[model samples]
Target: MRAKDVTGIIGEEIAAEYLSRQGHEILERRWRGARGELDLITRDGAQLVAVEVKTRRGSGYGHPFEAITGPKLARLHRLLLEYCAAVHRLHERRRVDVVAVVLSGTSEAHAAEHLIRGVEHLKDVS
Candidate 1:
C-alpha cells in the first residue's frame, strides 16, 4: 500500500492501543457510512466515542487536529448518528475524538521510535 495509507493504518492501530490502555473498549476501526468515515469507534463506560485519526510525516501544514474543520465535524456527527442507527445502538452519551500521529520518518523504524512525540489524543472534540 502507499506510504500515507500505511501511516494511517499504523496511526489507527496506535490510537486503538491508546484507547484500550485508557480503559475503553474498541468497537470498530475505519467505521464508514454514507456521510464519512470514523477512524475508531470506542465505548468508554456508557459513552460511544467516534474518533478521527490524522497521520502526517510532519506538522508543516498544521497540527493534525487543525485539519478537522467545522464542516468535517458536522459530517462526522451525521455519520456517527448513521452508524448508531444502522446498528440499532444507543448510548447514554456520545462524543467525537481526534487522534493525531506524527512520525519523524516515513519508515517503520522511525514511526516506532518517534511515536510518543507524535501521538496526541484529543477527546470530546464535539
Candidate 2:
C-alpha cells in the first residue's frame, strides 16, 4: 500500500484507541454511506459522534485538523444521518468531530487532537 494509505490506517487505529480510552463504544470504523465516509462512528454517552480522521506525516500542509472544510463536514453530516437511519439508531443524539494525527519522521505519531462537537449547520462551508 502507499505510504499515505498506510498512514491513514494507522491514524484510524489510533483514533479508535483514543475514542475507546474516552469511554466511547465504537459502533463503526470507516463507515460508508451513499453520501461519503465517516472515519469513526461511536456512541459517546447518549450521543452518536461522526468523526473524521486526518493524518499526515509531520505538519507539511499544516495540522491534520485543518483539512476538514465545511463541505466535508456537511457530507459527513448526511452520512451520519444515513447511518443512523439504516442501523435504526435514529433516536440517539448526533454530532460531528474531527480527529487529527501527526506521524513524525521517527515512525511515531507526534500528536493527535480530538475535537468534539466541532460541526454545525452552517451555510458558509461550501
TM-score of each prediction: 0.87, 0.81
Task: Candidate 2: list runs displaced more than 4 Å.
Answer: 106-126
What candidate 1 gets wrong by more than 4 Å, as runs, is 107-116
Per-prediction CA RMSD (Å): 2.2, 6.2
Per-model CA lDDT versus the true structure: 0.81, 0.72
C-alpha RMSD (angstroms) for model 2: 6.2
- Candidate 1: what lDDT? 0.81
Candidate 2: C-alpha lDDT: 0.72
lDDT, candidate 2, at 37: 79
Candidate 1 lDDT by residue in tens digits, 1-126: 666677788878888998899999999988878877888999999888898988777767678888999999988888888888888886447888888887675465444455445679888886
Least lDDT summed over 10 consecutive residues: which range in candidate 1?
108-117
Best by lDDT: 1
Best candidate per TM-score, number?
Answer: 1
